[model samples]
Target: MSAHVPQICVMGVSAAGKSTVGIALAETLAVPFVDADSLHLESNRTKMAAGTPLTDDDRWPWLDAVGAEYAQAGASGLVMACSALKRVYRDRIRAAAPGVVFVHLGGPRELLLERATARTDHFMPSSLLDSQLDTLEPLGDDELGVAVTVDRTPAMLVSEIIERLRA
Candidate 1:
């Protein structure tokens, strides 16, 4: 495991504000924030844009790459936005980047879908909401992570994380 105690993963369903909040969290922590979506291949982007939900295999490499970055981060921890919907997906990332911590941002399906619907130019379409939900695992008490509700202001969420990390 890496020695960094608080390397954070701002994870959630699409449109759940992973990218938006990850950037803020990273800035607050004085670390680099990465948008994992930028790492997506054009093919995957095309597939999702066409209303297709990606299988686990489609996401494996991307997760691996993100994990690699985490491992190489050394003391300068990073925050990243990734829809780590399943336990397996999270496991793979943690496996590569030991000591990685996740901040699971979750919200009501209706709220998420509404945001997705309002978005433009994003690769993911609102139609895949159901598929995303099918794979989502709410962070459990024993999950070795923080589960924060995304139903509040970003500042509130960031404050929650900042306090958690400090504690």
Candidate 2:
């Protein structure tokens, strides 16, 4: 693995506040912030906008792009928001950027649904929340990261993640 401890990925299902917390966390760490959703291929975006969940085939290329972005950032490090909802997805990214750490932002399905429903401009429709939740695979015990509940304020969550990383 590379020695890029702070090349962090803020991961979660939709409405888990990956963007909000990821941007804040990047600012806190004084690193560049990238939203993986922005890296999505137009085709994937179209599928998502059309109320269709993407297959792994649709995601592989996008995940590769995301991984490349992280690897390209190099030792300066970066904070990125990605819906790395499965272990395989995280593994794919780790394959590209060996030392990327993942911060799994986890919460109840109801909360996620509420948050997704409240959003208007995002390409991911609220209806996909169930599929996202169903697909989520919690961080394994050996994963190089921490899992924080999103029930608290972003500041609190950021503080907790910082403390964990320091350990």
Candidate 3:
């Protein structure tokens, strides 16, 4: 089972580099990648774009669908970029695939807000940054396999993850 490849959820609040690092990692691993934001309903996107935070109830189904897609992928692993801020959200993913590994892209909130502000036309607005940060849960020390922060370059981040997986 050393080659056991679980779906990788590149998770964190907005602007934490989930999508950036996930795509690079997917390319390096030659696996398919999913931008979890793409699965959001138009209404959810609009709400967030309007600077409204979505409740957990509103996010449950959307999260489920992303998990379902990877669960359906069989042997091939998938990398998903998402702001799975709450432990309950992570729990849902675990329920779908026990082997799913979450790579939390975490860092200083001010840095994230700055990045969010610089981005254009994104669904998540800078206004909700604090709430996103509030909802974040750091991985427990013995949780699973590799869990990393967004403090490094994309290549470095991907390299660290690949090394962890290989070990």
Give the number of the best model, judged by TM-score: 2
Off by over 4 Å in 1: 1-5
| Model 1 agreement with the true structure over 126-160: per-residue lDDT tens digits | 88988988889876665666878888888899999
Q: Comparing candidate 1 with candidate 3, which one achieves the higher lDDT?
A: 1
What is the clash count for each candidate, in the order shown?
0, 0, 0
Can you rank all candidates by TM-score, best first? 2, 3, 1
Quote the lDDT for 138 in model 3: 78
lDDT of 2 by residue, 1-167 (tens): 24344799999999999999999999988999999999999989999999999999999999999899988998998999999999999999999998889999988888988999999989899999999889999999888988999999999999998988878
Deviating ranges (above 4 Å) for candidate 3: none
Given candidate 3, what's the lDDT at residue 14? 92
> CA lDDT, every prediction?
0.84, 0.92, 0.83
Task: Report the number of backbone clashes for model 2.
Answer: 0
Off by over 4 Å in 2: 1-5
N/CA/C clash count, model 1: 0
Error of 1 at 151 (Å): 1.8
The whole-model C-alpha lDDT of candidate 3 against the native structure comes to: 0.83
